[model samples]
Every structure is written in structure tokens, then in C-alpha cells.
Target: MKIALAQTDIMWEDKKANLDIAETFIKRAAEEKVKLILFPEMSLTGFTMNVEVHGEYYETSSKNMNNDKSHWNFNRTLDAIKQLSIKYSINIGIGYIEKELEESKGKNKYAVISALGEVISNYTKIHPFTFGTESKYYCGGDKISYFNIDDFKLSTFICYDLRFPEIFQIASREAELITVAANWPKARINHWVDLLKARAIENQCYIAGVNRVGHGYGIEYNGNSLIIDPLGNVIGNCLEGVEGLIIAELDVDLVHNLRKDFPLKKDRRESLYRELAGEIIESIH
Candidate 1:
């Protein structure tokens, strides 16, 4: 499968400007015959906690519903991208802050839309960046989701979820390709690169990490969007301090062959590990 990583600079809290920039990248990726294109975390807005301006309303009544107007700018952005995906016949993965009526706090999510312009998968970030006070504003998700695109079984994750290996391991059981959309800063870029490779190697699955470039708020993001093979080799990289699209072709057979050869997952002792971890947590508490 051919995939494109859109490494671009996000305009701070400017959805209109960001959507315009994203449209250009989507068109360019389509021109290259990219089957799937992935964007960074909060693709339309920078990592900001001001939910009132950046967040979209979850509920829309008929009284407020106009074909011309949306309850949230994020909805309009998705509408445009869905149309573009259908027009280009390419699958698109977008990261955004999703506002849900049940949860007024909103959550960080990534949605994958098929070439048919239908939402195939919607995954909420399981881990919120508490250090940055993200947990205060955004609610963390409790489940992992996987979807199918042609022959590939894919899973999606957001920025801070990259640090958790257990979730990747769970997804790897059924997924051959994993996508990570991140807003990782330059200061801790080394961690981003190392963790991506580690997940790919340990899980024996293809990993595509799409991170943003340039600065957001006061933090500098170096892009470093990467595509790693099952053997932990970097097949496609955006390098540091660059903004553009990076494309790579992934093979499903490679993941199968590697797993057959190594069979590391089959050897895992999940029950024992869970017991040990539980004990440790209990002891700490």
C-alpha cells in the first residue's frame, strides 16, 4: 500500500488557514497517486487548550442546522476533506479535537475516511499529555480501534499514545499497519524516533508516524515523520526541520513473513505480566 505523510506547519488556532493548507497537500498527494495520506495531531489547529475557540459543538439542532453553516469549523473541514477524498479516490487520515455531546470535555481523535467518503474508523487518543495540562481539557479514550482498507488491517493513534507499547501490541495482534499522528516537539524528537522504531520492531508491523513541522505556540516541532518496516528499517523519513509530503509503499507479506520467522508475540506471558503490573501498582498505592 502507498501512503503519504503530510508534514506541514499548523497555523495556531486558525482553522480556515490550516484547512486551506491541508487542501493543498491533499491535492498534491492525490496527484502522486498516494493511496493514503496522514496528517499530524490537531492538524487544523495547534496544540491549544482554549477549547471554546478551537473546539466544535457536538450537538446540532435543525434550528441551527443550515446546509451552508456547520455547528463547528472542524465539521466543515471534514466535509471538505471527505469530498476531496472521494474526488481523488484516496483514503485520508485526519487528526482533530472531537467534541462529543456525551462528553462535554471533548477528546483528541483521528478519523480515517475511505475513498467512498465514508468514515471507516474513528479512534480517540488513549493517552492525553498530562505534563502539558492536556488531560485537564481533553478526555482520554479507553479503547483501541482497528479498521480495514483493502488488504491491510490498520490502527490509528495520536501523539502521546506513542509512548505506550501495550496498546501497539494489542493492535498488532490484528493490524498490519499502524498510523501515529503527533505534534512531537524538537526537544524530545529522539524519543519519537526511537519509540516508533521500537514499536515497529517489537510488534512486527509497519508503522507510519506523521508529525508536524515548524513552531506551534512557543514549541519547535522538527517533523521527523517516519515510515518504518517490520524489520525496524526506516524506509521513509521527513528528516528534521522540513515541511512537505513523504510517501512510502508498505507490503503486507513482509509483516506476515517476519512474524512467522520470529513469532515473538506468541511467546508473550500476558497473564503473568498483568498480575505483576497489578501488584506493582497496588504496592505503590
Candidate 2:
């Protein structure tokens, strides 16, 4: 399948400008005939945690009040995606913050809007980063989620969720391709690259990561968005701070071939792993 990673810079709370850019990118990706296009974390409004400034209640029909402070306003964004999907005839995965079930109110949770323009599944980040107590602003996702597009079992993880291998392991068990949409900063470029490769290698699945560019909230981003094959080889990537679509062709059978040759999944020591809960788990990257 042809997948395009839209490595665009977020507008840092500018929803209108961000939506405009998203529409343009969708048009560009459609022109290239991409089957799936992935955007960075919080693609519509960037990764600002200021709920008062960026959040709004989302509904099918609601007033566009600038002062409205809810979790997020996803109604407009969803309508845009529906229109674009019909126009482009392609699937898209974009991230955003949304008001959770009333039982989940006052917590932080990010959601991925599906290609059909409906929310197929919503995953709150399982591991929220604490460099600034991000979990405080959002509710953490309870479990790994996966969905199918054609014959592919696809899964997703948010920014800090990339650091946790257990999350990918769960997803990879059923997923042939895993895409992580992140707003990672520039200082951890090495970690980002290494971890992405590690995830693909360890899980034996195709990995596509979409990261933002430019700067936000005084933090600079090194946009090394990458697509890795099942063997953990980089097939395509973007340079830091560059704004463009990075496209790569991936095969579902390659994942099968790699796992067949390596047989890592079948040879797993799951019973022993439960006993080593406090011990360290190292990646093969």
C-alpha cells in the first residue's frame, strides 16, 4: 500500500490556519494517489495543553464561539475530513483532543479520527510524558487499539507512547503496520530515530511515524518523519524542519516473510516474561 506521512508544521493553536494547511496537504496526497495519509499529533491545533485557549465542545451542530472552552471542537474537523475523504477517495488518520465520556471528564485523552470520517476508535495516550506533566492535561488511553483498512491490520500510538515497547508489542500481535503520530521535540532526535527503528525491528512490522516541524512553545522540532520496513530498514524519511509529504510503498507480505524467517513471535517466552516484571527489557535496535 502507498502511505504518505504529512510532515507539516503545526500552527500552535491556530485552528483555521492549521485546517487550511491540512486541506492543502490532503489535496497534494490525493494527487499522488496515496492510499493512506497520516498527520502529526494534534494536527488541527498543535500540541498546546492550554485547554482554555484551544479546547471547545464538539457536536454535530454547535456555535463557533471563540470563548467556548471544552475538551476540543471536533465537529468541524470531522466534517472536513468526511468531505476530503470523499473528494480524495483515500483514508486519513489525524489526531486531536476530544472530550471523553463524562466519567472521563477532567482527564487527558487524545483521539484519532478515522478515514470514514467517523471515529472508529479513540485511544488516550497510554504513557503520557512527564517532562511537563502532560498526563495532567489529558487522560491516558487504557488499551492498544487496532483497525483494518482493506487487508491491513493498522494500529497507532501517540508521541510519548513511542517510548513504551509493551504497547507496540500488543499492537504488533495483530497489526501488520503501526503508525505513530507525534509532536516530539528536536532535542530527542536521536531517541526518535533509534526508537522508531527499534519498534519496527522488535515487533517485526512496518512502522510509519509522522512528526511535526518548526517550533512550538519554545521547543524546536526535528522533523525526521520516517517509514521503516518490517526488517527495520528506513525506506523513506524527511529532514529536520522540512515541510513535505514522505511517501513509501509497503507490502503486507513482507511482514509475514520476515516473521517467518525470524520466528520471534512464535518463540516468545511469555510465561517467563511475567516473572521479570521489575527487570529491564532491552530493544534490539
Q: What are the root-mean-square deviations of the candidates from the true structure over C-alphas? A: 2.9, 5.2
Q: Which candidate is the best by TM-score?
A: 1
Ten consecutive residues with minimal summed lDDT in candidate 2?
100-109
Q: What TM-score, computed on C-alpha atoms, does each candidate reach?
A: 0.92, 0.87
Model 1, 1-285: lDDT tens digits are 889999999999888899888889888998988999999999899888876556653335223445444443446556767897898889999987766434557788788989999888878899999999999999999989889987899999998999999999999999999999999999999999999999999999999999998888899999999999999999999768988899998899999998998899989999999999999999999
lDDT at residue 195 of model 2 (Cα atoms): 97
Tens digits of per-residue lDDT, candidate 2, 1-285, equal 889999998988887898889888888988998888888988887777775444443553244444455634455655676677777777887776655333332223334444566665556677767786676676676888787776788888888889989889889999999989899888888899999999999999999999999889898987899999988899989877889899988899999888888889887787788757635443322
